[model samples]
Target: MRELIVTNEPVLISYAEALLKDQRIEAMVFDRNMSLMEGSIGAFPRRLVVSDDEWAEAAQILRDAGLGEWVVGNARK
Candidate 1:
């Protein structure tokens, strides 16, 4: 699992999660408690997850859906 961003906003998180879900890409968000904590540059909501064995396909799905900005590390084909 890897973190792609740190946002305390629920709406954004939900949007991303739903998009991933519709594509049959299983994912999980962590640092939910950080939402309540004051994000002081470091403390922030972390969405932690991987694309299973279907990462390549999922990456394209995400790109087509306008989430290409979130791809982390070398998500190679």
Candidate 2:
């Protein structure tokens, strides 16, 4: 899987997941347990990832939904 977005905001993660799901893209949330174990201190941000082949489409779906700024690395632009 390729990491797409990393953030401490749970709402944003959920929103992004929903958007991707609507487009028939599968997304996985990583580090959710770690973040919870840390008591949501924001130290361990959750990661949204997709299969390597789906990464580009997933990123574009997020970008088109006004979440371009949240896409990881050069994918944000």
Candidate 3:
């Protein structure tokens, strides 16, 4: 899997996940439990990831949704 976005905002992650799901791309948020365990202090930022094979398409989907700023820089290939 590859990392797509890393953020402390759960709402953003949820929105991104929904967008991906609408396109049939499965996304997983990592470190969510860790972040909660850390008291949601924004310390352990959560990561949204998709399978390596779906990274490019998922990134493009997010970018086209006006969330390009949140997409990871090294998303290519």
Candidate 4:
């Protein structure tokens, strides 16, 4: 698995996951708790996680959906 998307916004996280799922790419969200923490105070950019294997695929899935660009393997360069 790999990280498909990372955002403080829950809607973006859920949207990306659903979009990637349509492509058969496994997607997950992490740092969700950080949102609660931030909401209590004030912050942003909470880290999200996905399986390592799905990194490239998930990133591409998001990209294709016009979500945003992400680093993946050679794309990291």
lDDT per residue (tens digit) for residues 1-77 in model 1: 55543455677667777877897777788876664576445456566465456666656666676766665543545
Candidate 3 stretches greater than 4 Å from native:
74-77
Best-to-worst order by lDDT is 3, 2, 1, 4
- The residue-level lDDT of candidate 4 at 16 comes to 70
Per-residue lDDT of model 4, residues 12-31, tens digit only: 77777677678776555566
lDDT scores of the candidates, listed in order: 0.63, 0.89, 0.91, 0.60
TM-score of each: 0.62, 0.90, 0.90, 0.65
Clashes of each: 0, 0, 0, 5
Model 3's alpha-carbon lDDT is: 0.91
Model 4 alpha-carbon drift over 4 Å, by segment? 70-77
Backbone clash pairs for candidate 4 read: 1-51, 1-52, 1-53, 2-51, 2-52
Q: Flag clash pairs in model 2.
A: none
Task: Using TM-score, rank the candidates from best to worst.
Answer: 2, 3, 4, 1
Supply the TM-score for candidate 4: 0.65
Rate residue 34 of model 2 by lDDT. Answer: 92
* Candidate 3 lDDT, 22-49, residue by residue in tens: 9999999999899557776788889999
